[model samples]
Target: MNFLSPLTEGLRGLGRAVLFLFTILAGIPAALLRPRLILQQIYSVGVLSLIIIVISGSFIGMVLALQGYRTLVNFGAASSLGVLVALSIVRELGPVVTALLFAGRAGSALAAEIGLMKATDQLSGMEMMAVDPIKRVIAPRFIAGLVAMPLLVSIFSLMAIGVAGGHAIGVELLGVDDGSYWSQINQAMHGTDIRDMLIKGTVFGLAISWIAVYQGYHAAPTSEGVSRATTSTVVVSSLAVLALDFVLTAFMFH
Candidate 1:
């Protein structure tokens, strides 16, 4: 019975998260009218997350180049560095990694901020004023997360292509023929590849934002509760992104 308690709580949490998502979606029409709020949340969630995204994307791209150069060496196909980098980043790495990072940074912050508001009675205060916090607050953050995620993913792909594929590995260090690298990528990649990635980013964003807000909104008004919610937001969001990636990849590729 004791062991089952955790499982029960987990199920309850999942149900709550799902219900919260429906509420957020239902409020979307009204939320759109408040563009200012959505934009502010976008800056908070997206713009603030850019520095980490850029730095992480750049370094990861360089590292991928370094490792990929070794792997392609075995086949004497070093010129395919661009193909390897582009395909890996565009198809999988870019969206997945960006979402994971966003979950850690922005998602945690969102959870904490919302949780703190709850603790301070601000959420309750809104109810007293006949205001729906779901529409005014949570919906905007949800929209911003969805919008920012794809943009962040796009930026990540660009960094990976330029820094990892073009500059670090293919051109500057490896001396691979630039013409072969670029031509292979142009020939290998198609519109579907780009479309699938956008789909992935959007899905990941939706999952992360929902988890973050759900945890915070339902959290107990205590320091420990808020802390737990914040941590849960990151862990759950990251796992959700990876799981979604696997499922999305299977369908997209199959």
Candidate 2:
């Protein structure tokens, strides 16, 4: 009981911190009326994330097709390759993988940048000048992350499908029917899966950006503190993505 108390308290603190940051982000409109911030967010979150998501998505799809084909062949069921690839990539792999990549790329950078600013007392200087740090700094990043994640995930899903389709054509060298491949994929992709992917991407994006900024804002006032905060940001955000994935899966599927 004594040991569990610390864990519970820590979780409670984390929850409160997240809620506070989210509340600030949500209230940005009334505080800061800048259209440029939205454009910046779109560029930072969406445009910058395209290359990584595309490369990762394409390779993952190819690998999945290769692996799935080999496994299904062992059971004399090779014709179902398209269904398996599409279902796995769209329903699960697309959103989760893209989000994890986004977290590692953009999330870490956001944390380090904010942590550095805080360590240098720039944030305090802004506050002394009557600037609202939430409006000027946090809100833009939060909105950018939220908007960019879904766009990146959708691109990833599309690229992955393209890669998988090419891989399927190559698999026909082993006598798999080309006509049956696309048909199986069409059958497997339900409308609900698309909605689930979008929802999961949005949730993951919000979690990653929120955690990154929160860690940066709360970091200790030292170089080592900034480093620790950056590390914590990446680790915590990745774990949160996975945990939320499970929760979403259960809720959406059950």
Candidate 3:
């Protein structure tokens, strides 16, 4: 009975999470009609997240180039480096790394913002004023996250593929033929490849953002509670991104 308690609780939590997600999605249509609010949220979620994405993407691409180059050199197929780097950055690293960073940066921020609101009784205050916090507050942030994620992922992939993969390592360090580098990338990468990556980004964005808002909205109205919710937001969002990436990869590729 004790062991079953934990399992039952887990199932209950999962159910609540699903219901919470639907509630947020339900509010999104109202948010879409308010472009001004959505734009502000986009700036908050998307623009604010750019610096971390760019820096992380650059370093990750460089590291992949360095490691990939060593491996390919042994095979005497170093020119294939471009395709390798492209596939990695475009298909995997770009979306996964961007989502993780977004979880830490934007996801954490969303949770903290909402959690703080709860802790301060702002949500209750809205209720007293005949306002629904879900529509006014959470919906715009949710919409913004959905809008921002794809753009952020695309920029991250481009910066990684262009500067780190193409220029820095491929051109400067390894002396890979610039023409061949780009040519192989063009040959190996197809529309489906890009489509798959974007799909992952979209799904990840929805999941991470949804988790953040739910955690915040349901957090206990205490300082410690808010802090705990914020931490959980980051941890859960990161794990969700990784897990989703695996499932998405399996379905998309294999």
After superposition, the stretches of candidate 2 with alpha carbons farther than 4 Å from their true spots are: 1-5, 163-179
Q: All candidates' lDDT scores?
A: 0.91, 0.83, 0.89
Specify the highest-lDDT model's number: 1
Off by over 4 Å in 3: none
Model 1's TM-score against the true structure = 0.95
Candidate 3: TM-score? 0.97
Better by lDDT, candidate 2 or 1: 1
TM-score of each: 0.95, 0.89, 0.97
| lDDT of candidate model 1 versus the reference | 0.91
Clashes of 3: 0
Evaluate model 2: give its lDDT.
Answer: 0.83
**Tens-digit per-residue lDDT, 14-71, candidate 3:** 8998998888889888877889999999999999888888888888778788888899
Off by over 4 Å in 1: 1-5, 163-166
| Top candidate by TM-score | 3
lDDT of 1 by residue, 133-211 (tens): 9998899999999999999999988887785434566678888787887898899999999999999999999999999
Q: lDDT tens string, model 2, 124-206?
A: 99999998788888888878888899889889988776653434343544556776677877787889989999999999998
Q: Cα RMSD (Å) between model 2 and the true structure? A: 2.5
Rank candidates, TM-score, best first: 3, 1, 2
